[model samples]
Target: MKNSTCLQPSLATTVALPVIYSFLFPAGLFGNILAAWIFSKQAPTKRTQYVYLSNLVTANLLICSTMPLLATYFARGHQWTYQSVVCRIANNFGTLIMHVSMYVTIVILCSIALSQYATLKKNSDAKHSPAANENFHRCVLNKFRQPEFAKYLCIVIWLTVFCITVAAIIRNNILANAVGEFHTCYSISIEAGKFTSMLAASLATACFFVSFMTVLLSYYCLNRHLSKIQKNTCIGEKHLIYGTVKRNILVIQIILTVCFLPYNIFSPFFYVLLPGNDCKKSNYLVEIKNFLNCLAAAKSSLDPVIYLLLDKTFKRSLYGLFTKSIPEHHKGKADIFTEETPDI
Candidate 1:
């Protein structure tokens, strides 16, 4: 019932996103690019965690690459037509890509948590071995634990997310076409697409919660095991190993909580919960939503800090980048990944 003028952008709304995102764009680009380069320098071993971590870097890179477009959209999206080709491209590349990165990062972090737990579980078991009844163990997410299989699964994840995102983009463009072009790209007429948008948001919210729980559960079990060891004696090698592993899991959980939680919690409100007819309420809510989304998109830059904290090889590789003094530089590639290096 309200006119489009009701939710007109405030100067804060206009300036905030572009400023925040412009800064995020360069920082994210440099961080992710640095991460990818460091990963590439690692010895060629199909370690399962490496696979997930590399894909995470790739996902983060995808998000950061779109920051400029997203920044521009926040500043000027209302002036564009959703049905235009350029608008559609921006919607997909800038907005849709952010969601894709979000979900991809979530799923992969879940994979990492579960995979690490499985590794820790098997290692703690005295009877567990390479040939110890893999048939029974295969049922326990073992398929994802294998490096070769992990590559295939990561590919499937990318494809599945792309398919879903593209479908949403197509549906929006079609609806925008039908609704007539004057609606402005930013105001996608809540009354027209409320059902579909809310349904999608509900599904995505459910998925996010599932990933959140998975990370929490993994952290609990891992920390519990480590707690037992540390209580006995914190000086041992086992205590140190499990401690680092638990810290890594904790960092992942923190990233999910800080970066994505607010967005997921508030996003579903834009359709069904919020009264779009109320101008003041709608305007403030829209700004909040955009700011929350900016936070979600910020994980791309934060992941490199996690890598530094959790990955010894990556840390050493980063050190390698600056220093020419490689330890045993003459040692062949085969000797690089020695038995002395515990693959934790």
Candidate 2:
């Protein structure tokens, strides 16, 4: 039988993670911070997309916040020198941040779907009364679309994620106590740890499918609505709207798959679920898990880049930061989000 020690990841095998972290930590820090700064400079608008985008930037900031500890962990060759409690907190906080990012992205896509529906209603029913149109607008964009709603939603998400993080931290600390080690944390080793890891993986798998479907449904609805308008509108205008919406949709899909899917799908396999010991294979599996873990971290940084590409307001704010003097007319908050992107 292969020796159990051989199953432990070697320095060579572990090298990739710290290298990834080296880049992710700096990039995520710069990008997320810039995103937050840009969002801060803008005033809250009546547009529902502004609320959703704000929440997304907040989530991205949380996700990026975990990188310093992670970079240090990998820098030290997989042995966490921090206290066991700190280790547990860091790991679980990372989990909390990831879930927040996932849920916010789902909400953003769903809102886009809702916007598409509203546009269809307005376009198809030209004879609709002014009162009826106002009612429709309020229903679609103002019921729970206010900055106040976003504030409450974030509070609820933070509370829920906090509970889960605490539970995870407790479990890890309990296991660390049982093993007579109070300086390191492992995701899977004993029966309890394996069980917990599997449970988390199951949850992540469910989220993956749900979010993917939500994005697809949003894209389909938006495309259908755009198609209906193509006949009446100028060809150039129709194609521009269609192309921009499609581009944004594609960005959403790429980020969702690239960041979350690997960790969700392969995390379960990292545990030795079968009866027999296979240390060599197990080690390889764990290495893959770590690699995916780094990829997941990359999303926090990439999200800000997405915002820069897709959000005209955010792009202007970002551009304003570097330029010493913006024209007096361009500096106002109201001017930032007024660029028309058709129905998007």
Best by lDDT: 1
Clashing pairs in 2: none
In order, the Cα lDDT scores of the candidates are: 0.70, 0.57
Return model 1's CA RMSD, one decimal. Answer: 4.2
Question: Model 1, 11: alpha-carbon shift in Å?
Answer: 2.4
Model 1 / residue 330 / CA error / Å: 17
What's the CA error at residue 286 for candidate 2, in Å? 1.2
- Put down candidate 2 lDDT per residue, 1-344, tens digits, no spaces: 32223345566445666667667777877887887777767735655556656666777676667666665554442354335555655565555565556545555544544443344334333533336556765464444444566556656755654565446556755765676553334323421243554565566566567767776766776567566556555546446545655666666767767776777677555543433466566656666766776776687778777777666667667766788555565444222122243432
For residues 1-344, could you state the per-residue lDDT of candidate 1 as single tens digits? 53434557777656888888899988888988998887777735567877887899999999988888877877877677655665566666776787777788888988887776666655554333345575576457566668888788789878877777667656765765676543555653522244445665677788789999989988887677556545654435654555556666677789889989898888877655465477677777777877888888888888787677656666677777888656665343222111122432
State which candidate has the highest TM-score.
1
Give residue 37's lDDT in candidate 1 (0 to 100). Answer: 87
After superposition, the stretches of candidate 2 with alpha carbons farther than 4 Å from their true spots are 1-7, 43-46, 77-148, 175-187, 190-192, 231-239, 268-276, 324-344
